[model samples]
Target: MRIGYWWRLAATALLGLASMSQASETAEAGNLVYTSGSQGSALHLGTRLDINVQGLQAQVRVAQRFQNTSSEWVNAAYVYPLAEDSAVSGLKMLVGERVIVGEIKEKAEARKTFEAAKASGKKATLVEQQRPNLFRQEVANIAPGEIIEVHLVYSQQVIYDAGEFRLRLPTTLTPRYIPGVSRAELLGSASVHTGASGWSLPTDQVEDAHLITPAQHHNTPGRLLNPMSLNLALNAGMPLAKVNSATHKLAIEKPAGAAQGVRSIQFAAGEVSMDRDIELSWLPEPQAAPVAAQFVSQWQGERYAQLMLMPPRELAEHQVLPRELILIVDTSGSMAGNSIEQARASSLLALNQLTERDRFNVIFFSSSTHTVFEQAVAATPANLASARQAIERMRADGGTEMHSALSRAFDHDSSGEHLQQIVFVTDGSVGNESALLTLIHRCLGDARLFTVAIGSAPNRFFMRRAAEFGRGSFTEIATADQVQERMAGLLSKLQKPVVANVQIDWPQPVEAFPRTVPDLYWGEPILVTAKLPPWPSRSDARVVITGESAGKPWQRELVLSAGEAPLADVGVPVLAQRFGREKIAFLEDEAYRAGNSEQARDTVLPVALQYQLMSRFTSLVAVDKTPSRPAQVTAKDGAIANAMPAGSGMQAVGYPQTANGLLWHLLMGALALVGLLVLNSRGVVYVRTEFTAAAGRS
Candidate 1:
């Protein structure tokens, strides 16, 4: 009698789960079908970015305005990308006159708060991080013709290397490939985030495959979407000699009486489609170039400091060594157009750079791995010709099997006399980043890995993190024109170690991020952050950095008393936030490197909560106390689309989605309950995951 009652109760509770397929929306041109009962006019979203740069750090405010054109009420969502190191610190929702400020909360609590507000017919917003570089923002209860704007503020450090300070802002993402069997395939019963559907399902390796592999659609030239407005203000703290953008034309503003060190820049075209990221770089005055600098801030009675030090340019004498060179190329579908061309050009350049003393091999991967030679062979004329012909004939197709390629490249004997180096060229478009990074950490074995990021909008997070793990450097080549200039420099650097055995000595006891220092490459800087325990507030402390450059001991020092010159941007809160972000990243990397993520959540929670940061375990949520929608009116949910990344998959036949995120899994717990009840309350219960969709981007 008890079993019968439980069975009947389960069927009644999860009836919606059995009928969810009927609610699926038909495939609209580029709009992803993510929700049940999704109807009415199309939803639209507008974006604007305001960037402020001070010295080596930048803070950006991104506003996403969701416009509901139809008469029916709707809930809107969007998926977007930011710099990999961006520390999301603020979120606010604007409803006409009232600005609802968001508060940091545990991920589950934030979701609950948003859902409660949504059910109460109140306007609210929620922002969550899926990956370090990718985020999903949702606004609830947007009325017809209403413009609800969500403002997000994040901070990041600018890249200062090779004689310039550079920054990239991501606008669109590349659809990443998810590898592993579906949970259903492994267990005969699957757990999927049915609230949102994409081109993929949940896999064993990546439980959130549906979130990262957002649906994409063909973005024809005429029907481009997600236009953006950009504004930038630069304060170099010192006079600048040159400023320019590699991705867009800028209109430099020279206001009367403005200091030469401060400048305002705007997009010459005003508003542009969000098809790719914009990259800007600047060079400081030759006389004002800095070799060492430091920024410090305080939080909760403790002090935080970030330091940058560069070794002498002439510290290393270039010495060529016999090397075992391996060139691994990506022929994935994402590299179908200009991306493939640039990668091919880079491969050929690397092939020609190999000397007769080098033992070389070639690898190409897409869906599976392939090798030109089973083992490294002397770079003789015959081998060189064979490699050149194979590279030239490579075509882009299938999924990006990056792990297989790396395994094949690094699985050989490293005990040889030659210096072992692997040059991996790809768009870095795979979603299984932790798996690959962990693989490198385990099997690296005296082998150095260098990544050549090839694409107009490559995954910067993967490129930067992989190189850091491999104890190597990364170079980004955005176009065919940059192949020669960029590849030549990278190939040149691979010939010898720029700086190794890097170590830092602080004047006092401190806890630093990156617990371990990494090897520095040509034109690279040693950047670090730390927390200074309670101590005398003295200004005489010094930080000494030491590294081995060309078999010589190299040292540089920065006086902590000397803040940035001109006395501006010394104690900004963003510096502390940057430290918090780094610390959280360190915890994550350490946990990942250890091959276990179970403790990562608990380890990073304290830092994220104490610093009010948005992290993997924490989120930002805003709620309005007053109810704005009538109880009689029902609100439909829709996803606002993003522009397809420029020059990506130009020849691909089909595209699935182009936008942010809004999916409803009404069967959140009902299906799990049913599964348990049906199996005499002993079967595994799979709770539905959350909603999100976006490529792993810059």
Candidate 2:
């Protein structure tokens, strides 16, 4: 081919490539995919959160309202996140005046039932757990202008540490990075993958990435955007000095007269955009701070109790251990904006916390891992300066290759003299969480792994479990401003001794979980749930918990008879459901460690069904027998995109777009132009003879 011909072809291809770049950039904000004829579906979205905090347990009711205003019959789906340890207990589907209660069944069975109901034109809703924190709710057979509301209720333990009790309410999730090879179809042109509900297909590492990785879209006129409100009624059972939220402004008021209690709390604004996780923390009066607590409930005439034991901060006070701290920060594409800034600030703050006796290193990971130093080094001023510079120079881009990053940190040939603690700072956006958790379970020897979750909405499930498996703590830094304060708290705990090798003794025969206890730090406590024999036969039940704090054995004994310290007596099934949830977590962890999730699915099924809770092995499904749609009309699927986490600068979820209209159309157009250019370069199409010049290529 003539040089001029090649030059002309090169220029055409470059223009096409630029257009593709812009389209792909738009995809980051989200590519909401709706079935044909449903693009104009008017979606009205709102979520109501009703939370009640009693003692150490919180029960949350989530009511998601999705109204379809389009002329066509439609089915809708929404993907969202919950607290990692939430014990989901109830699901109800409401339409107009009737209600259909959800029942827990094996995941496959639930799917079959939902499909059958959908095929028969009946109204149905299926809720399944995609991950510990991620969930998917699908509703079928909605008539035109019909309103559907799926209400979910779950129970989670309130975290108490260092004089504050904390609870997390997750509204959205960060766009996770799915690591591994994309399916051949996914790698094809955008046309081949268009209209898929999720941005990602099933990858080799994450077989169900599509389920968890929902697409995001802005609150455009034709798209569904979720905006939610949160209302909490807190009866702490005691006096609280203050109550506040780090993510949302609070509006607190005493419920009607008799007014001395901290009563009901709400958001200052009526409704806020659902983009970030809310961290609600409350400070109790010093004298009201609990040292031990126990809540009991009755289910099927059996007693279930939740236990909490704080092993005294004084023990961790006098003990300090020489350490080997390895800072692993993620510089992935999802962390490109405020997320990266927080990670950077956190890394620097941690470096400042190292003592003379501690040895430290820094590692950054995106598509690949980059170590600041080959191995752990003394925390001298010079070495610290070098680490800080490397961190400051880091930029966020590429995929989140977490597996390689973690493996590199826990290399077999690392130091064994000092106590090694791995501090992983990231947005926690990876999809292959079980694989990473399994790796940590096997590789984490004596070293502790502390995960600092960055960004507005991180993967709480992975962050919590990774820390649990590595015998450490999980800290969340949502913004750049939070980095200094949160990192300081985490680092201070890192320098102190953790209460390890914990064992609990119960007064009577009972079924309880977590089978094993992880370490406790600072004022952190030990929480356990148990199913006891029918009550009234035992002596005043005294629960004893023992552990080692600072190389010294420590013990705490609490009377479960219910006097002053811990509130007792309950009517709800939250504790019982929590026991089942914990049991399932234990079994799943064991299965993950053994590398056989499918083989162990059976072990978690019974627990899930028994407690009426949702799990990986089981799901909650509600079906209304009456058909809601006409037989002649087909139910078109509606695309309800997940809201991207706040501060994720990608322009789709509530941001202005540089590119507009159909993405696949633009892609195909660009591809066609490139094809024409290629044909012209080969002389298939007529081109001027003088157009080919070697100098033109340059």
Candidate 3:
């Protein structure tokens, strides 16, 4: 009897399981679609950035405004991008004429505080780090037809590359790919948050996938929801020869001098759609770049110094040792347009740099990985021709399986005869950065991995970190026009190391930002920031640096003058912030390698708290305290969607949130239950037939 009852129960369960498909589909589809149709309207967002330049540093103030056009209270969340190494220092919430300053707190505690404020009818704001370059901001209890403004400030050192000073700002983001074993928990939490977009869902691999993946407007013919205006004050501290925007149209207001002085620049148009990255480049007068510059400051009885030392560039010599070059390309759907084109061009250029003695292979990956050969082959004419044909015929489709592709790149064990160079060509559109870096570090045995960023707005944080772990270099090719120049430059650096075995010695004990430095490339500088004790005398303190160039020992010494004029009042804080950030990064790396979350937290918390900075495990929060809204009316919250990156594919790629191993087992059990029912029915009919036949015979 129990068995029969179980069979009946099983049949009922199977029907329920079959019916769940629709619900799962609906939930996974996001908030844009319902049984009725598309959503009514979207939350509007606007941004303004004001920048001030002082020598090598830039201080920026960003104002983000949110407006609710609907007839109900709405809570909004926004995720945006910033420079990879930015030092976020301040945040304020502006409501009416009052301002609420944000304070740094532990990440979990900040979330709980925000949630509590949200529950009680109070206006609150919270900012948390999603990635090194990505952040999420939450604003609660915005009444109907309300306008809320959020202001933030951060400091970052400008980029100096190839005799030019450059500053880049990312205005849009390409959706990232997450690869890991799926969990059943993601599907059940889809509806737990309001104001979510229709494009993504939370997943096990990327817990905040829904937060990072914003709604994209494809071919919409209206004013973009997120339009940004940038104003920059350029103070290069030297005579400027030229200034121009590499990626956008800009209106330059030059100063009243000849090729010198500060310049004011703004968008040529009033504001621009957030579709591409903004890059501004300026060149100093010929042969006028500083080879070494130092800034010193004193605060709270401690002396701080930040300096840059550009090693003299070495002439390129003939290649003596052969190399093995492994090229890994991302052919996922996200690379369907201009990104693929750039990657193809980059691959072709890399092929041209290979010599007859070198060996090479190509690995292309999306949902699955494909290789041109089982192992690397010599750079022969026939092999090159075959590779070109295969690469050109490839098309973009399917999800991004980045981990598998990376594994394929590292599959071949080196015999220690030749140097192995893995050139990864991608947009760096993957969210699981920690996992990827961990994997790379584990498999990166004496192999240098250079990342070729292939799109306008690649993930800067991921690309830079990957290069750091692989002990290589990173370069970006934003457009096809710049491919030749950039790739040629990269090839020039591959002949030999500019400097190696770099070591710095201080006259006394001092704390420096990086305990160790990477090998230097041609024309690259060694920049270090340190905190030191008060020197005995101006002439007595000195620093000695040692390195090797072209198998010859090289050394330089710099004397520290404690009585020298201070650089700026702000320099001390800037130096301290940079040092703190590096320390946190080191601790996080150690934690990742050992898989010890507790250790990471314990080590990083004190430093973060002392510096009052935002980090992966720490956040910035602000509360109004006064209950602006009644407790009875809870605010409705949702995530605001970001604009679709220009030239990126419209097709989406990721694993199904509802599909997992446990679910598949239950489905199989249901199928077995149905089979048993059919068998029992057949048995009953056969018995009845036999009994009837016997009765007739009697």
Candidate 4:
């Protein structure tokens, strides 16, 4: 049976208040309705996903419908997931025939505007970013029995790896572990008792803990809580050897006698459950894989091009350098279920790959850190056995203190002849990404860091960015079955020499994003977007790329012509959007190292405003001019819960509880209990028995 959204929220809030005296105990025991079981709430959440893929890029539209099933005014809040690097360009609220468009404003200003409009009983929508991959949408004064739909559109460059092009749509997110001092010391600025769907308290580490920590519901067999539908159209431009989905079952259809190779794919089943990530992959035919592919368009008297350059295969080389591998694992409460199992298995596999020439150490961390050995040890039988036992004995509990573990891994001596490689194995469920990435950037020297993301809904944003900063690569293992296959490919890349010192030369002036090209891993291609000078002559323009593999230098060049070429595709805006995202990320990294400065704003805000993207300093908001709800009616806020990620346990309830959270609830409960006891002692409420009278009568 379906329940009303506001009614459920109201009930949760009342329960929350009543349990204030026993807050810590209730939290520890997982006694609340939202935290007690794995069953999903009766709240119906409907989602529709529309995707369009255009040669290495994807444009996506997601429409979420939230309906109020009860007879009370409710304020709805939903925290959802999107690709970390997505360039969000549009947000709209659908109300009957009115389409309210959202405008970009500074985050604080936008929040203030939305709050003011909401206080005036005007219908308003606010979209705020809690993490790069996580977002919260607020809809104020939703009337009883009202149905509201929010549409969000974003664009991103697709992932190309290991000869396959892949795209992933995260339907849900795993609960993240935020580590820091207790809530009493740092303290949160927001209310902790907001009727949010997830089991978590406001923490000192993550200020918006109430916003990000959502209630998670278990999925029962044959009963899916959140229903979602997806439709995808791929215009690969070249013949496809095969198209497949790694996560869900989908049907692929190719039109008969199609002019160009366009494949239409749809979910095989109807209304699939939003539990795991939806991953789709396709491979081009052996003959169709281009050595060099280029697309060009002209805008504002300047030329722009998106180019892909595939490096020639390397010949067998005899020399192989030894490595120093540091494997770091997370044993936080969030990793208590299938995630920990997968992490352990993946670590064991990684250990087996270490040869005698390599030396390694294992660091297991949760609230604390433990290293298998004080220093890196050679991969001998006894050391491997000890490492295996340590991994086997590890359990998930406590806080997610990642900084300590990371510091230990990166603080090693740098004068060793062995190549230092740190393999971080976790769900990437930490909230402090910017701080961690900054730490990596500062401490990383001659050491490469790779991220092995485990579990169903790991934070790919952190994993991907960490790898990018560490000059390594990132891979995800969503299910136990994929551990071997995915790990093998990753191991192979690690064994090979990476292509470094890449240089791209153009005949004329050109400005490119990254401004610096990253090292290319084995089986990967160099993809670059550049703003080029206008054609010098009617003749073709030459572009050359040079890189070093092992000790050998390799170069490739392509002559690009503006005229008389049928392959020219219009790619200005998408190219521009990609460039904008790259530049913003670079600025953010800089600001994280050195505090935010006017220089960053002068460089970033203009680009962000010009590109119409939401960032740390900016937000997207929409408001209705006419007041809908009456001023007499009080407004309340509630958070929508996300479904529990598959393979995870009931540990999602507000983990890493603080003394303040527990003692506050306890004090209230103790006072209430004392009042009840006094009333009983005074005979205010008494019970009488007729036992004496019955005995006398007998």
Candidate number of the best TM-score = 1
The ten-residue window of minimal lDDT in model 3 covers: 689-698
Candidate with more favorable, higher lDDT: 2 or 4: 2
Off by over 4 Å in 3: 1-42, 184-199, 219-222, 257-261, 316-320, 561-572, 595-598, 652-698
> How high a TM-score does candidate 3 get?
0.85
How far is 411's C-alpha from truth in model 3 (Å)?
A: 2.2
lDDT score, candidate 3, position 222: 60
Question: How many residue pairs clash in model 2?
Answer: 2
Q: Estimate every model's Cα lDDT from 0 to 1.
A: 0.74, 0.74, 0.70, 0.71
TM-score of each: 0.87, 0.86, 0.85, 0.85
Q: For residues 1-698, could you state the per-residue lDDT of candidate 1 as single tens digits?
A: 12333333344335435644333434443332334445444444567889999888889999877667667787765677898999998889998999999989999999999999999999999998888998887788888788888899989888887778888888877777766543333221212323333344446677776556554444566654666788898988778899988778888886678788788888887877777888888898998887887887666566778888875666333465789988899998888788999999999999888888889999999877899999888999999999999999999877777888999988876636799998989888877888999998898888889999888778889888998889888888876777998898787678776678888888787888777887776677888988776566664477888888888788888776422222353323776788889999988888879988656999898889987899989999999999999999987764555555677764311122322211122232355355565665566544433212123211
For candidate 3, list the clashing residue pairs, or say none: 194-637, 194-638, 195-638, 195-639
Candidate 2, poorest ten consecutive residues by summed lDDT: 689-698
Tens-digit lDDT track for model 3 on 216-291? 4432456553778888998888878888876888998876873464899999986877777788889888867877
lDDT of 2: 0.74
What would the TM-score be for candidate 1 when compared with the true structure?
0.87
lDDT of 2 by residue, 1-698 (tens): 23343343344344434533332232223222243424445364688999998878899999988777667777776688999998986889999999999988889999999989998999999988999888998888888778888899999878876678888878888877765543423332432223324544445677775566555654444443476888898878777788888788888877776334356888888777787898888888888888887787666767778888776666444467688998899987778778888888888889888878889988898777889889999999999999999988998777688988999999835565688999999878878888898899889877889999998888888998898888899888876777777787798778865677888887767788877777778767788888777546657687889888778888999876432222354323777788888898888899889977766687888888787788998889999978877788887653466676777754442111222222332343355456666886888964433211110000
Runs in model 1 with CA error above 4 Å?
A: 1-38, 184-195, 222-224, 315-318, 534-539, 562-572, 650-698
Off by over 4 Å in 2: 1-33, 37-39, 184-196, 218-225, 257-261, 315-318, 534-540, 562-572, 651-698
Note the residue pairs that clash in candidate 4: 4-70, 20-665, 21-665, 21-669, 38-218, 197-215, 198-214, 198-215, 199-654, 200-654
Model 2 deviation from the true structure expressed as Cα RMSD, one decimal place: 7.7
